[model samples]
Target: MKKLLTLSAIAASFVAPAMAAEEVNVYSYRQPFLVEPMFNEFTKETGIKVNVKFAKKGLAEKLQQEGEYSPADVVLTTDISRLAELTDKDVVQAVDSEVINANVPAQYRDKENEWFALTLRTRNVYSSRDRVGKLGNDFDYIDLANAEYKGKICTRSGKHPYNVSLVSSMIAHHGEAETKEWLEGVKANLARKPQGNDRAQVKAISEGLCDLSLGNSYYLGKMVNDKEQKAWADAVYINFPNQNTTGTHVNVSGMAMAKYSPNKDNALKLMEFLTGDKAQQMYAEVNYEYPVKEGVKRSELVASWGDFKADKISLDEIAEYHGAAIKLLDEVKFDL
Candidate 1:
């Protein structure tokens, strides 16, 4: 009886740590369909289970409130602006993984290693291929303000985060004065009041209410694959604007290690795994995004759209300038 008791105690001790170490908690702004399969695959490959909580907003605040008691080991979110907010709030920590360093480009990863982008989404112009023809060739976003496109261009409200970042990129590239003028000019060219997401703008283009619009490249991918969206995507010719000058404005869906992650090692491992070829490819192929991992092929659909130079501006700068971009939008009466 004594020997059995001692053996039982030893077994419990070993099992407890094993059970604790086998799980990682994640707070994600990305939809479950976008992230779950990868998590399921990770568990299958490594035996480390993932516990995820999905929300569209307030994740950073939730993480901040949880603080040291937070069970989250990792955070995954879209857009550089939100990631920058997390970094500013110190909700995430810098990770030094050699795999991450090698795979993610410097422009896509935080300089201090707080976060790294796994996939890229380029914001570019889309136009009616048949309507513009040669005029669409070698076109750039800066050309949106040209008199010819006035009352012919359609886009989301500048209040939208995506457009804000694009405007911010212009500010970063052209300085405040020039950027303000550019915003006012683009505002002058609106086909109608800015009031929808990227897809809606594409719909407007397809309906002949407009001839061109700005949208993320992945939207085109989603459109082509989705039965309902195929017509709108098919109706437009994709153009990667600003290619010769500053490259296409790109953003990311990225990941970071939580500041008080209890499963630090596992979290880092997961981050590295995401940056690996398999996960990167899965992310891009599934979502119609460009992989940040070097040499990972984009989805055939994305590749079919052809390639363009991506803006080299550090996305962190885009984040930093977000507020000013919003102010510029207001000042130029972009919303009205």
Candidate 2:
């Protein structure tokens, strides 16, 4: 999710005032320089015109083969299982908008408003501050299936849709037979076979091979503005797991509308100007994320990675337990 926002910089076009007879095409699976400075400040405050296209996988089957002649009046994505796979393929469209319901948070949108959730990420615990210092945060996630952290955890593909939306919120807080015996004790706490891409499990715990991993707090603000991963994100410790019950399991970065949105009133005024407050503070200063609205401040490197409490279930009740969290990660082969 870093480096890939350039298709000639999304064919350069912001058109703030001079010639915008209203517009809003977007299809973004979020990348064009992390949402083109909030669609160039929502086309410099309502001159409309905001036509992005970026992709990182068939923009939902190209909006189901351009249905309704898809010039796409908004569709953007990122987890909540691609907004429940574009609402089980109906391809989005409900938006009632009380200014995006007073700036999102009906458990991060889409109880029928189709989809909204602008930003907020979490799937934390990256530890390893030189062999778990800072009291190693006593890192919970049910201690990655305790057995005293067997093999010392590390992950990536428990059918990744961000670890199957955190194993479908641990099957909406422990259900599928204790979430399949807690995903076979988190796949027997793997340190090796479950390879790469959560900053390669924080560069495999800054190269001691493993000491826990399962990232996505804006990839530690893209590895503190990476320069070859800033010493593997300064050898870890991002923590934030279940602050004593059901919290810390957030997810989102949404938007939806294109079920034939021939610019539905400029795509409902660009989804109520991206949930107001200056496009949620440029989605927290150019996408470090965590702005599901309410008082939007947090991107001074995601408020220095602090504060917790988020998992009150209902990401539409954990996207209805994502096919029983991908069939309990294929009955616990969890990236074997």
Top-TM-score structure, candidate number:
1
Model 1 C-alpha lDDT per residue in residues 1-336, reported as the tens digit of each score: 999999999999999897776888999999998889789889989889899999989989998899999999999988888888899899999999888999999999998999999889999888886677434436777889989888989998888878888989998998889989888888888899998899999888888898889998889988888898889988898888876688889989899999999999889888888999889889878888899988999888889888678889998888878989989988889988
TM-score of 2: 0.35
**Per-model TM-score on C-alpha atoms:** 0.94, 0.35
For residue 131, give model 1's deviation from the true position in Å: 2.4
Clashes of each: 0, 0
lDDT of 2 by residue, 124-179 (tens): 88878989754233355767888877888888888889888888888778788987
lDDT of each: 0.88, 0.82
**RMSD after CA superposition, every candidate:** 2.3, 17.8
Best by lDDT: 1
Point out where model 2 deviates above 4 Å. 1-20, 25-34, 41-48, 51-72, 80-82, 89-125, 132-143, 150-179, 184-213, 222-233, 237-257, 264-323, 326-336
